[model samples]
Target chain A: MINNRVFPWLDERLGLTTIYKTVLDRMVPKVNWWFTLGSATLFLFVMQAVTGIMLSVYYVPSPDKAYDSIEYIMTGVAFGWLIRGIHHWGATLMVITVFIHMLRVFFYAAYKYPREITWTTGVFLFLLTLGMGFTGYLLPWNQKAYWATTVGTSIAGSVPVIGDFILRDLRGGSDLSGVTLARFFSAHIWMLPAAIIALIGVHLYLVIRLGISSIPKENE
Target chain B: MARSGNVTRRGFITSVMAFAGSIMGIVVGLPIIGYLVSPAIGGRKTDSWIPVGKLDTYPVGVPTVFSFTRSKINGWEKTTNSYSVYVLRGANDEVKVLSNVCTHLGCRVSYSKDTDTYACPCHDARFDRNGVVLSGPPPRPLDQYESKNDNGTLSIRVLES
Candidate 1:
């Protein structure tokens, strides 16, 4: 249903060729399979975002319904299990790939000169990924989630100066309640994701603008 | 062919990073699991104590049935459950509050002045003034509530399971 001329018609104003040259048509030193981890992490993040959005359709943030809604999603909705399964496992895989990608960059000394900001953003992204994991673990409102959160919040309370404040702020009260669940849900679904997206945008732009790092040689 | 379970230095570092990464994940991620269902569900105390009446209003040597209704907002729906407890007042300001439902089959038990026992009509089960089982097919004694008397006012804690 689309005209063949549609692309050029838009490209003339959009400077599609310039973007392609800058982003896709760059030259880089030879590298091995380790370089693929970065792209793999990107792919995993995309998968998680898509699957996570699909899950939010049926997920309820309230305490009473939170656990039951997850059960219903696993059993009641069509292909819901598969979607959640991907989201759950994708979170794990994303963390792995991101870590490996960071190790790769570190070993390659890519963070030395021009890519310091890239590494910084990557580190924050890693922390954000963990943040996503932490916030997401409580969504099911299961026995393990409840006790783990209790112990976890208590551990946070062990901090010296602002420890009590952090624990109370994280829990939203003296005890874990629906208020806490609501707080975590918003951070997991909105705040963390928004920050991750913005950071990813900057990281990718840097990766594109400054090209991938080259492999090192022995005889300097 | 290389040996299985054997890794180079790079592979070794990778595995170490993976392990360390998982530990860091738990340390950071576990705490984010902050707010649980609600503190009211499984908590030390609940605001579910119902005020029955003045302590002196219940006559000594007889169990007085105090009935109350509670409306709770459970998620999306409003559920109201009726609960009743028998307040047994004795000499010297001693008070024993017991759930009026029979322990055997949860059948409502009424105080029978004729027999001087709490009787369940569902079966011929009976409990004496102290709520110990007297006769019939009841398995255990009647359930007792935790009651508190503050300044002549009596209240009982009811945890609906």
Candidate 2:
């Protein structure tokens, strides 16, 4: 009785009833555990954002102090190890889920017709996720990070005429110096996150607009 | 017509609510913007003289290992780090403090007395007594801290890369 009265009041004030009927009253086809991968990927992204924020609180981006700061976070800060571990594992899990989601969409022919834009956005999001991984890998500033980045950027330098340009842009110079660390730190923490968030907005909007695709059947 | 000239009840309330919301957003957003941009705009590293040890303790004509604890504050995080360096004292009382980190890949380089060189265990990079790169994949010489001998105490100013 109270909900009836309160809901009417809210609907009268904010038009909530109209929004609920339009957005929440939609029909969804029968889906199994496979359908949950997209939601799982979304959940992992949120987890990454939360843990990444906590990490940014203690992570220093300089060449001089980056590794030490991570060590401090792992050993010194309270519950730091758990949070960092979650962030690390969450990133790996997100990549896995996103790949699975893409495969499910492709194999079911869900990307056909109206869902082409959705598939394209998903591809972009996949590349951005990989970019996030690559950039975040270098922020630790360990021997592995330093050498791997040197090797990674050198591969970028192997691309035809634009190779050196891409390499210099990525490293911020001819050599992997402090500037590279700072640049990667900024890209990892700020620019990529911002881009991912914006892309996620579009991706979610498209998903909702088109509704979830049903699994392909043997017969029509 | 006169009733139409007056604002509707819903319109007046919504206008007031929107104004309040804008004010709230500005109040919350300003500090967040400042916090995000401060690290990029602020000075890179804090400059200070770290005291290593006494001049008398460092043996002459030998690379004595000295480890010192330095606290570094970067934005919101503060870390107390123990760093090692090789301090070689000359006959004329001049001191050379070489950073033990290899120039190749930032691994800790240890002094091998038998080989008379600082060798990195990670990549087999070697540096001679003068901190010059001897062999392997090191691109440059080992880094050195600017050391100062004040009276009988030794202090060093760490250079940022």
Candidate 3:
């Protein structure tokens, strides 16, 4: 068949058959729906990235115009409401799925022994995900957003010796001015995203490198 | 010995290719990254004087509502925002522009002719014609915009919050 000829041609030039055999033919323990949460989290992350990028195409990050721009997106652009709604809901869903995934890993005690690196990286990933949510919440610059951020950053100022420094660093100044909006906007869209992607790469590499931990049997 | 020599040559070729590939990646990636991040670094909204309307249109001794649209560009995205201001013009050409947003929770305050006061539906806050809080939960007076009357035309300078 033509399929046989094309596959062999590709296999000869690219060693596709060898890669498939090595990666896809590996054995895994029989897992239930709980084991699928990790993949679900990954899918949600991709969805968030795509939707977030679409939103950034029209979102303004300045305090003076952020709310207005959001209004424009909601009323003027076609399907803008749908996209924004999905992004809003998707973020909440991603947080939930990630939390559930972590719980699954912990309850299974998969974080023990040789998988220590994987667990540690996962902890960082969880914190990074929360950071993304916190930063993104302020981009709208509405009343709730402004007040919530004011309170949130003030809490950071309550930490000991370096507290003021942390607050100033987060807000880009002593107060939540336009500079704070700009800072959070950049962190939400750029810095945190880069960190998340890098961490995800390493996490996945570790997972594959160590192979998935099997479920503990009743007698074992 | 022949097999060992062949393996060493393959290893050397692989390392050289890896180095070349990385160099190419940097050369191609830097410009793309710069293009993407330039907006975040350089795009700060500047204060500008936005024209509202002609001075005579605003009635004296009463707060007349005027709505205007301001277009903003953040990076590549452009959006138009509609804003409303209560313009109070005095007999002696004294002009005051008050933001409709409530001081309590940032809700839009509307003029109620029945009560002759500006009221917020969000928290039942009220403000007099001069924008001073009359009742309810407003923490402060309504915000005012810096306005100018130039050749019978009125404009307001919006400041960054």
Candidate 4:
């Protein structure tokens, strides 16, 4: 009832009808459920945001409390284990979906022609997702996180001339300490998420603007 | 574009999208609500009997300040808190412990033998030997700790909110 009465009135000013027609109501190419991966990846990102925010409620970024805080979330807080489980798995699944979605586009030649920019953005999204995984992996401050990050940064330090700068920049110093944890946490929750969200906005706008590509047929 | 009597291509796509979107919503919606509100609703109280020292160590008719460290779990970290209290020894083996925290702005209050009154350096709030507010802007008297003596050892029951 509210939609029938209020939608038209609001749509006049907001162009809701125009958006619906152009964005959702337009005819897309006939495709199978493989087309759903893009949407699925988007859904997983939303899940990441929800669960990540919930985790941040109790998560401490400091070296002393980061591990214990996660322990507290897993054991003490109600439904915290479930939220974190979803986030952890959702991140893994998102990487898979985005990668497969890119493959699907490549196979169909959907990245050709007018979709070049969209394809470029999609690649960036894939790399950013991996970046998210990398940054997020070190937040728990356990033996795994500490050693893995230590080895990971050391690899960067092995690079040519600028290796030392890269390693120091990543760790916030020569060693992994409270500052390193703080930096990773900031990137995990803030910097990487911002980049991903902005890229996603561009990705979706292009998807809607150019319309999804159709499955290729035998050439003449 | 043909409707085929009822459903169009656009209509079918919209419905399927809606269904899938709702599935996403239902999967993560409920648990996230419970997760976000869990900490705010669940809080634990800490209380203990903190021992001061031998009862005779505090001289009679004078208030002596004693401070100690109290550690408790604040979320994921163990936070150490400093708490000081004034121990007053009255006649007839009566012992009263008043929190050294000023009732006005939470500054430490010290006992001045010259004025014979507890003085808060922050706001110059003064209290009598009994810890009743005497002057300045303290709306209430200094908070008292329930104390007892066991074998000449004085301890106070501390309840933290």
Candidate 5:
């Protein structure tokens, strides 16, 4: 028998086995390539996590030396640039794939009554991915990263009365500096990931619960 | 009849064949897919200082853009790649290298000799002589790099931070 400790009461509370069965048996269609993008995006997330952790081992987040440190990783560390590159490109690609997946849903009108929550949750996840991308881009603190982010956040500062408040919260100051790095670091590593993972679980759960919609025929 | 058993056996064999084909296809296809997508997925490995070129190749009082490659690592793999740099030989004969990025809005800065400044047309921030903030909405000075010259060849290491 499997260890009760492994499965535990949490599994029962989550209804893990039943949920899995319903998802495998009912929801996910044994279709062609259209369904695979979601899994691919999830897989890319795992890749980002692994590569990002490896990079963090050597990344020092400070404006004074963030650029030098990244250079050192790219030049001195064994596989540093590779990890950074993967993190960089993987982020963009994830955003693209998720966008296409959403488009696929929209084109098919899959966001009908029962699936609205799924669509909404997916939208939240999409925004979170973009958040991850934007925040993570600043961690390098290169001129490109620094100036690009400065301009990007300045747009946030244009949101009327609350714009300054939001911009200050984002940069941690009027200028992008040590505090800004810290804020982006925290967002990239902790806050956004936590939010994304939690929502993803809910999203998958809803997908399982609702079951996959029949492929929308053009006429009907 | 004897033919009925043969028909059942044929159906069973066909099902087995399809299942085996799918399993084998997955087994074969996964590694191929992983390999093809690994660069974007895992990242390219990089290391070492990329060499730019000879010092005399750039004239004093002129800005020359040079490019080089660095090796990067992602997990167990390594990749060497090219990146660009903008080097300015100042009027005072001192070599100053800056990232080709504008401080005001992250646009590429171009040398404008008539104005004697690096100007960002995006938002009108201008840096004169030593990358100091002169006008417009730039929060800081343009970035500078550590440069080296040996045997009349000038080389620089570019950082992505």
Candidate 6:
């Protein structure tokens, strides 16, 4: 065990006093499963970041070579197939896990009153995850991928007066092609990630500040 | 009030224990999660030349079946699988390799000698020797591979979709 010697100036201004720890002790329940979801989500996010980086190293986002590049990984590159497979399944798993975590929070009525900001941030994060999945799906530009995006963009185009504009913005043209792949790649690898990380940081800070919700009064 | 206060103290201690337990759990569970979720994130590489066999063995103007085994490590674990492709030598002397799986839904297609086109028995889809979609529900051309010639051997790398 490592010894932590209290430094001279450390305990003064930052309130290094264990008072906050005591407050957390008084508020949080001991054996509740609801509390596990937050950490689990964080775990999955870290896994996503690492695996996503690994995949980006070999993934070609260009239209001409994207399909072939993926095939090369599957058939020729060292452990490339497995890496791609893991990234694929990992995404599906993240979606499932995030949804389940949301449900847990909802059922516990953890989103009420003081936690409104946290809940709202969480809802945004959830949507971002879905968007990430959607954008990432088209990067392969395979048959399933191509048609799926076509269907997805058509749905976007169905959203009343502005739908066509949204579809055009997404596709960068009338049809899904090279421009669209690059757009999705940028959104998947950069834009969404930046947004999600910032939102997650806020969510966690709020959680730490407010503490996990106390069980609804009579429910115990 | 004394009993209520004691109960609160007990609850607090339990929360602390739970947090500690969760930290341990995360340590143990992360690698498992990593192994399971790593596949879909990366784009696949189909950039290398895969050997299809001898140039002489591939008779001119006929489709010949070729296959190779691919094994890869995902995380620390290794797995292997077999992939097959159909190759045909055209009159122009260019060798073409096409995925045998039908483009519509992945059923195997065959060469109809009389028609000189590849036909999918399941869907009646037809493609010329080059795997071009001649008719039916196939939305695009048959998937093609990048071909290479090695010291009298004709090899092709199947590009992944």
For model 5, state the Cα shift of residue A90 in Å. Answer: 0.5
RMSD of each: 17.6, 18.1, 20.0, 5.2, 19.5, 18.0
Enumerate the candidates' DockQ scores in order.
0.02, 0.02, 0.02, 0.65, 0.02, 0.02
Tell me the tens digit of each residue's lDDT in model 3 across A86-124: 789988998999899999999889999898988998999
Backbone clashes in candidate 1 total 0
Best by lDDT: 4
lDDT pick, better of 2 and 4: 4
Q: Give per-residue lDDT, candidate 3, residue B53.
A: 89
Q: Write the per-residue lDDT of candidate 6 for residues A30-115, one digit (tens) a residue.
A: 54776677787788788778768777766789987788767766765556666678778888888988898899889879999899
Question: Candidate 1 residues A1-220, lDDT tens each?
Answer: 2447888788889998888988878887788999999889988988888778777877899999898778766765556677788889998888889899889998878887788899999999999998898888888999988888888889999999999999999999989999989999999999999999999999999998788888877763
Query: Which is the leading candidate under TM-score?
Result: 4
Candidate 2: pairs in clash: none
lDDT, candidate 6, at A176: 93
TM-score of chain A of 5: 0.87
Q: Residues B15-126, candidate 3, lDDT per residue (tens digit)?
A: 9999999998796456445433544564455688888889988889889898887777643356687789999999998899999989898889998767779999999998
* Regions of model 6 farther than 4 Å from truth: A1-27, B1-161
Query: What would the per-residue lDDT of candidate 4 be over residues A1-220, giving only the tens digit for each residue?
Result: 7788788889989998898899889889899998999999998998899789888999999988888999999988888889889888998999999999989998889998899999999999999999898889999899998999999999989999999999999999999999999999999999999999999999999999899988898991
In terms of DockQ, the best-performing candidate is 4
Would candidate 4 be rated incorrect, acceptable, medium or high by CAPRI criteria?
A: medium
Each model's TM-score for chain A is 0.95, 0.92, 0.92, 0.95, 0.87, 0.86
In candidate 2, stretches whose alpha carbon ends up further than 4 angstroms from where it belongs are: A1-11, A14-25, B1-161
